[model samples]
Target: MARFTLLGTATIPGKGTELRLLQRNDEFSIKIAGSTGELMNSRLHGSEDALATLACERISELPSPRVLIGGLGMGFTLAAALKSLGSDAQVTVAELVPEVESWNRGPLGGAAGYPLEDPRARVHIGDVVELIRQSPAAFDAILLDVDNGPEGLTRKENDWLYTSAGIHAAQAALTPDGVLAYWSAGQDPAFTERLKRAGLSVEPVTVRAHRPGKGARHVIWLAW
Candidate 1:
């Protein structure tokens, strides 16, 4: 593998943590400034796509479905959701870091086919919790891929999303038959029970990080 070249860095608004963008050949990676692990890589997004695909499939028949995505990451989830949705569908992406959105608009855009450019896609630069709180039975599907997983790696605040309160908020934000999907690096039986306690039916699906039957195994929890 070739050495990675630093592209840019941005500090997470309230958290004050820095995120670095690096590129090696045609591939791109985003990592926390002091962390050794990559937060997102353009080459691996199978689970990210699954997060949206699994959620979208449930609401595909709705005449004008509305979807909410918690994190943009490399835009893989957003791209996959747009691909699965009909023209009348609208997808709102809530991205905490503005630079991540910018990266996707720039060179990182091509990695996911520039889903943000789609007319049906909307960008919200703020905490996804705020969006869920304000919305009441508004979305047909809500996909969360923020901060790695339920345990969280980048932000401590992300832990709230996995808590019972957060689960209820997500539940209230969904339509009667809406779906909520979460992306995780690994599975958590506790989180599965948490969703059930919040009155949702949970289905945990394992997916590959790179391609089918290849790469790391990740998890996607579909709740309705």
Candidate 2:
């Protein structure tokens, strides 16, 4: 077995949480410094890819569609989104931690074919919520893969993204036909109901972490 090597570390601003990057041979993993679980892995990104593909498919026909992606984990979602959208579309990715972006620009990038190199991609080193609040009705789709889910396992501040107010902000940020998608480690029925209360039609999808028919199950909520 190849022993894991520590690559880099970054502290989550405001939250005081440290994020560590490690590599075992060609595979990379990101985890909270003190946690035993991985936040993201270069190899198990099927669900992340699905998050972008599924959301972009709905808005594919729109002319010059605008898409917002929260969390640039391994660049899988961004790469998947870009592939699904037309060449005229623009994708803006908001990553709370700057180092994560740097990692993508470095060796960590090859896992998703270096999505940041895509000409249509624009990186934002700030909170996704702020972007959602400011861009009212501007995006054709918003995909969020930040944290573990609506439960805020990595950062307490992430809890807001799952709140009624946050949901409404996301609702207001979308075009009339826009979609909002969220990635989770597991299903959250209450979060689905919350989307309903926010007046959005929601669909919860179960996906595999690895390629189809393998690995752990993850959930993605698509609301429009």
Candidate 3:
């Protein structure tokens, strides 16, 4: 085993929270120095990839399907979306912290197969809420993995995305049969009801974080 090496840090806008990049024996991880500890570990992203795979499969029928990925943590979700979608599909990834995209281009690229370099993938270095706000039925699927769960951690404003208004915005941004998927460290029954109230058919799925029933079980809500 090797000790974790601190690589770089990025500050979350408005909230002022910091995200630290760490490396250890070829493994990389992103830790949020917020009240809630470690954010994501590169070695474990099975559920993250599932977030995209589960949603994309339902919407793959569309030609040139457009996807909006809320967060770009370690690029696992983006990489999986690119791998699963068709050649003409477009995946838009919005990452609030620019350094997260840089880390994906630098040390963490290989972990997710350098998805940022893919031609179909578009990277936006801004708040995903803005993208959702601007879009109106512009996407076939929206994958959200910004925080540990529906609740906000890294940024206070993220709470809006999970609220009724945010849910409405996400629904408005989606096509008629579009899918909305969320990756959470755990489950939230209230959130499920909210999705239903937003006029979406909700399907709550529980997936093992490390596959093969290895790590903790994570919940992904696939709403349409």
Q: When superposed on Cα atoms, how far off is each prediction in RMSD? A: 0.8, 0.7, 1.2
Write one digit per residue (lDDT tens) for candidate 1, span 47-86: 9999999999999999899999999988999999999999
Worst 10 residues of 3 by lDDT: 29-38
Mark the regions of model 2 whose C-alpha exceeds 4 Å error after superposition. Answer: none
Better of 1 and 3 by lDDT: 1
How do the candidates rank by lDDT, highest first?
A: 2, 1, 3
What are the per-residue Cα lDDT tens digits for candidate 2 across 1-224? 98889999999999899999999989999999989999988899999999999999999999999999999989999999999998999999999999999999999999899989999999999999999999989999999999899999888899899999999999999999999999999989999999999998999999999989999999999999
* TM-score, every prediction: 0.98, 0.98, 0.97
What are the lDDT figures for the candidates, one per model? 0.93, 0.95, 0.90
Q: How well does candidate 2 score on lDDT at residue 9?
A: 98
Error of 3 at 102 (Å): 0.9
Across 114-219, the per-residue lDDT of candidate 3 in tens digits comes to: 9899999999999999999999999999999988788887777888889999999999999988999998989899999999988889999999888857888999
Q: What overall lDDT, based on C-alpha atoms, would model 1 receive against the true structure?
A: 0.93
In model 3, the runs with Cα more than 4 Å from the true position are: 34-36
